[model samples]
Target: MTTSAATTTETPSVSQTKTGIRFWRRLCRNRLVTVGLVIIALQLFTAVFAPWLTTYDPTAQDLAVKELPPGSEGHWLGTDEYGRDMWSRLVYGSRISLLVGISSVVLGLVGGVVLGLLAGYYRWLDGPIMRLVDLMFAFPGILLAMLVIAMLGTRLINVVIAISIWSVPTCARIVRGSVLSLKDREYVQALRSMGAGDGRILFKHLLPNCAAPIIVFATMRMATAILSTSALSFLGLGAQPPTPEWGAMIAAGRDYMWTAPHLTIIPGVAIMLVVFAFNVVGDGLRDALDPHMDVTYES
Candidate 1:
């Protein structure tokens, strides 16, 4: 009777401890993670409210006021090469950057996950798929993107597709590793023994288990995608001039580096902040989602 009572008492204590740990893990309880979340939230807000946040039309250019420094009447962050408000363009331009970042990541994730899952599950398909993935891996991501863009003729959608192709190999490699590790686990073997279909075993049982790594990879990939977009735009293969893109803004401002430094600095800072935010968040997720890493919360 006493042992039974003790067991009951310990059960709730264990449950409570697990609950507390889960709470902390969900948010990653790390200082950098919190700061990253705040920065990301602010960027999202800026993107969502770009129209209301900016007082001037980003594309409406006044040649007379070109290259005005910050704090000139209506223009807060000053004017660019064509006298368009820098602040307004940066805010609106975020929408494009983020849109490309997220969409390309999603495309890459879908392609990678599908291919990796199949390659890992079926030994027959592994050689061909892995050899192709190996070929892609041999090329630097940016160079591969540049080559694809050059071949595709510099269209926006093609740029996204180009980046997505480069992104897929990395994600596929990660997922393949995960699936390879998981295939030998008892749960997977049990499912196989129980006559579970390959599709059910792969998707329902295996894929969900890979979520943590996938989420981390997706977050990191956002930064990569944004960088690729900016590089493409800077090279004139991305968003055209007068289109309020951060890369183009910096590209245009490069000639005035000796004089109108803010033109390049502002957009450069925006790219840096966005990339930094994604990286911090990705690192936090890695720590949080590591099941073996115990998170001790101090009240």
Candidate 2:
């Protein structure tokens, strides 16, 4: 009885210690990641509660107050060319940016993972898929997006599709590199020796190991997708008029840049902040996930 009781107590204590160690390690290596989380959370909150956060409807136009300065009586970040409230528009627009970024990344992740796994696992299949990936990598991501939008026409769904297409090659390359390393591991060889099927070995053994790098890449891609979406919207190939997109807002505010510099500055800063936050967080994730990294700093 005493032995069992002692075992139970020690087991929980050991687990608790491990949990504490993990928490401390994550905190130490990921302070920027924590800050990024806070920023992203704040953005999500603003997007979710946009109506409650602002008084005026983002779409409501009051021509009498058109182009009002910041902190105007009825408007906060001022009015746009259409006399729409800036603050409200910005708050609501967060949803469009986040939605586009996340959806595009997710679609890219799924497609890339499948194709990458197939290419890595089957030597005969590698040539065609890799050549396609190379073709995608040849073009600049923004230029590719622009081309895709030009072909697909300027709709929100087209923006997502365009971004997804540009993202897949990057994700495929990352996954392929990871799989190249992992496929030759002793455990994988053992699984093959045990007569494991290709499907099971690839999905069960290889795919899970790709998580760390995939996550790191996904975070970075999220930021990139957001920036690309904004650029597209700015060029009138993304979100349409009165949609409160950040890039569209910047485009609309360009004429006023000389008179009310705040117009472009606000949205531009917001874009920078969001992208910076994701990059910092991605770096933290990469560091934390790197098995070769040392947790203890040598004195």
TM-score for all models, in order of appearance:
0.90, 0.91
Alpha-carbon error at 173 in model 2, in Å? 1.0
Q: Model 2, 44-70: lDDT tens per residue?
A: 999899889999888999888888888
Question: Cα deviation of 16 in candidate 1 (Å)?
Answer: 11
The candidate that achieves the highest TM-score relative to the unseen native structure: 2
Model 1 C-alpha lDDT per residue in residues 4-50, reported as the tens digit of each score: 99999899899989866785666656887888888889989999999
Clashes of each: 0, 0
Query: What are the lDDT scores of the predictions, listed in order?
Result: 0.88, 0.88
Candidate 2, 282: how far from true, in Å?
0.5
**Candidate 2 lDDT:** 0.88
- Once fitted onto the true fold, the runs of candidate 1 whose alpha carbons sit more than 4 angstroms away are 1-28, 295-299
